[model samples]
Target: MAIDILVVDDEEMIRWTLKEALESEGYNVRAFENGRDFLAYFNEHGSDIILLDVRLPDSNGLDLLLEVTRVDPDAIVVIMTAYGDVETAVNAMKRGAFDYLAKPYSLEEVSLLINKIVQANLLKSQLHHYQEMLENKFSRILGENQKMKQLREHIGMAARTDRTTVLIRGESGTGKELVARQIHFQSARADKPFIDVNAAAVSSTLLESELFGHEKGAFTDAQKQKKGLFELANGGTLFLDEIGDLDPSLQVKLLRVLQERKFRRVGGTSDIHVDVRIISATNADLEKAIEDGRLRQDLFYRLNVFTVNLPPLRERRDDILLLAKNFLEEFRKEFSKDISGFRDDTLRILEGYSYPGNVRELRNIIERATLLETGNLIRPASLPDELKKSSDLGYVAFSQETAKPWQSTGFNFKDYIDSVEKQIVTEVMHEVEGKKSRAAEVLGLTRFALRHQLKKHNLESD
Candidate 1:
């Protein structure tokens, strides 16, 4: 990487000389006539290192150094002075100068100082990058809703150590991968690689080779020696998605790897030992599978040391509008649209619908709406079939318990009353698609009376 160096001196000769010398050494150099001049330009033209003179017309070098630190504390400062006083150099060093270069310094001495500063800055930058990547990788779970807040707290507790095996369970579109990423990125192995593989996506015939790799010419397709994800992810995280779909034989092999932290290649005999943290995700009902003699009980127990269950989007009604608005803004920029916001009717429709596909479905809806919408708002025409159907149906009580045909045939009088109430509400909403004023006018009732019926039925409108 090229080092950016700034030269600050009142003397024109010194400024030009340092810039020329530094530029000749393949460094980006900027020159300022005085401390004030440097500060004025620093906001626009910042550098990794600043070579500052002790005495200037506007300000002292040490004071300038303090100011620069305030702007960017990581910046390296090397003080230069013609006074060549050991006491003054020591004081500058005490005030956070990386080093002090005496006036009339040789080209070799200047080059040496610049190289040292560059090396130190490079190391600091690498450390910062590692921390930043870890933080960024786990930033997908930000939310104030109760479910996400609890999930964050659970992740925090699990990330306090590296010994725990994490099992993330959620619907296919409920961000299972995001939760797994949070566990690994926040753990001790954050500096190492994070390898992800979908167990169901890879064919069972090739999964063993994919996880354990193969030696060159070991099989017809094995033309070259390949490193498996486990070996590649050594000292880091190995995220296995759709893990419940892994075949029984492959599950045994994976269990062995988890137990021994070692696996043999597809056609090789040597066992490769790797230090990896396993984070697995699955959308299937694993307990039912185990009961049906499908999944191994021991393996399930091994992987479920710490479980995090993500609530689907429908369960977190409080986050629907928040997530919808975020998606709207994201797509607005992508599609180069100047959409202001979702129409109130559109938002109402979103809040009432059951998002079977969860956040992923919501994003897709917003993206499609933003691309198709010509006006500033997302209208009812932009909503999907499920949402539009729900709006027309108004508020039908969803029975948590599956309904039986016998119960439907033997409906009580109260059930008929409920059905009648549902019919009136649906007619009103169907006439106006849930606009309170229009629905109220059609029903020959005041808006307040219509709202009273809405409350009785526990219904909201789009």
Candidate 2:
């Protein structure tokens, strides 16, 4: 989309010059003679960038700047000031103006400012795309279990508010990040950015600077000014994962930002204020960490305004087969396979095993099974060895040596062994209705190992 520039300069010549200059550069430009008409137009239709004269005929320029921000806190504004009023221009920047253009400036100056505004808009566009994609990806959480029902209710209430600090607790792979993303995308600030930062991923020395930007030459690698996640996530959500890994010093800094909503960048003196909604997640026990001097109790209280604890997959077993079948069908379509469905025995095998890796692991199992399917139904042979072996625990009905074993029908030893192998493999396959992964599991062998035995015994389907 073309950059929409709103020029609110009072002088007829200035507005005309800006309109012509910006339009010549392929921008959509609108010029107003006074602040009243511009503010009214803004209420109806918003613009990408605004150029307001510091001394307007119909309104106080500073008051207009304040009102513009109140309408859109992330509004990009450039104040137009007289050459002698440079100090006032600086003050306007402090009041959230992007920059200032001095009067008597050439048309070339207008072109330069437009280029800068265009570049900034491009960045905003990228951020908006990312936000939209995430919100769309997790638009709905899949589960009909009672736990999931309660979780949905909590998310609805939390998203209604704009700036509530949310602390999400869940075991790893329990969809904690998904919950956080849902809250951000469902909230009033969904149009803004959702910046995710893993606290444990960065070193303590650099984590502070990464969260709160640093000035130029702040550190050895600080070659230029940088904005931290907090600054970039202004008017948006900051999803801090593994938050228990935060160091003590950074924890103090974070507490200050949560309480005062302001902080100084690294090696900077000025307090940069921001409006950021913090959503922190961690698998670690914060209470134990606090007792061990790893987490501060006060910071915990500030962030614990609302707590969301996610149930693990083991605890939510009712959703297991539902999720598994859904994943199976999805992978079937993705791989373009003709596998009809899971056998009843196959579903029993799937439900019997404990999923230590949770929903993520279950999805992976289904995907692998779907990709390897070469038959009508997903049988026991399609399952992993770990699951089958674990499922067969405590079920050694008899020892082959002690119990009645199949007598040799012929004198050839190799032929008899091959016949026994074929019989056992075929029986296991029939038991689970041809699910290869599950059959391999039940026989205490890998799918690869079972397939080799099948081929060696001439039991493989043509």
Candidate 3:
């Protein structure tokens, strides 16, 4: 994208000089003779950079700068002033002008100022692009289940306000951090920082210093001053994962910060005020913790202002296939594979299994299947052994240890035979510790035939 430069000066020679000079630098330059003509063009098509003469024939350049800033707060305007009116140029900068150019200024000076502005704008553009990508990534909460629909509504309500503390309750792999990100990206503080830390991942002493930084020489290891997550996330959000594991000593300090919106460093005397939204998540039951005296009731009250309870995967079985398909598409593009979809038998296996690890485990399953699948569609052969063992496709009653196949209603003979063959190959490979040549000799089969069997059962990687 070429930078568009708008030159607004009453003098025809000045306008012509700027247009020719900037155009030679590969910029899209447009010139106007007066403020009225410039305003007309600007109202229709905005420019990336503006050069406004301080003394326009129709209007004051300062007033025009205010109007431009009011319309577009990000507008980069450089004030063109006379050498005698240096104070006016300074005032222009205070009023949001990017910089100033004095009359009798050389074209070289103008080029240098424009280059600086271009570099600054380039950085801002990149940051904005990255922020947009983050928002897009976290905004997707995929599900069609009723609970999921209501959960989305709850997330929206939580995002509508900036002061409310959010508590996300879910199992370990159920995306508690993901919900925290969604709240942060959807809120008014979307452009600000979103910092997170796991309360249980660090020791109590270190976690204290991590959340509320220490003063210089505050302790034996505190050699220099450092900013904490709360201070770093000022005007943004700080997500505390596994909040239930926060130490009791730190809980008192955190409660003070939440109640008063202020805190002091570990050994510092001065109080530091901050405006940060705290979003805490945990897999433990806070009510139980409070009863057991592990969690402070007051702190729990403060953190639980807005609660979002995520449903476990087993509770919302209808969304299993929906999430599976979404992950399949994601991995397809990522792996550059031509997998069109999941086979019917594969879908049965996927939908039948109980995901103890929830959505995270399901994603891993699909990712592994997508990589191992050799055909146009994901087949049951690509699934893990656990899923096959528990699948409702007539394999659940077959006992590998006893070599017994129990007969049941709606049992498919072909699937039963395939399961038996897969189990035998799996057991033989496991017995030999995945040494294919030795396993082939034990099974009285050729090496090529063993390799073929392993591929058929999707155990080639093992």
Best by TM-score: 3
lDDT of 2 at 170: 82
Off-target runs (Cα >4 Å) in candidate 3 are 1-139, 392-462
Tens digits of per-residue lDDT, candidate 3, 76-185, equal 99999875476897899999999988888999999889877865665465457556756554226889999999999999999999899999999878888878878887
Error of 2 at 194 (Å): 0.5
| Order of the predicted models by lDDT, top scorer first | 3, 2, 1
Q: Write the per-residue lDDT of candidate 2 for residues 258-301, one digit (tens) a residue.
A: 99999998988999999999999998889999999999999999
Q: Give per-model TM-scores.
A: 0.58, 0.60, 0.60
Scanning candidate 1 in windows of ten residues, the lowest lDDT window is: 392-401
Q: Which is the leading candidate under lDDT?
A: 3
* lDDT at 298, model 2: 98
Give the per-residue Cα lDDT of candidate 2 at 365: 86
Clashes (backbone N, CA, C under 3 Å), per candidate, total: 0, 17, 0
Better of 1 and 2 by TM-score: 2
What is the C-alpha lDDT profile of model 1 across 115-201, one tens digit per residue?
Answer: 666545544554575577555522356467888999999988877778678899998799887777667767787656677899999
Scored by CA lDDT, what does every candidate get? 0.77, 0.78, 0.83
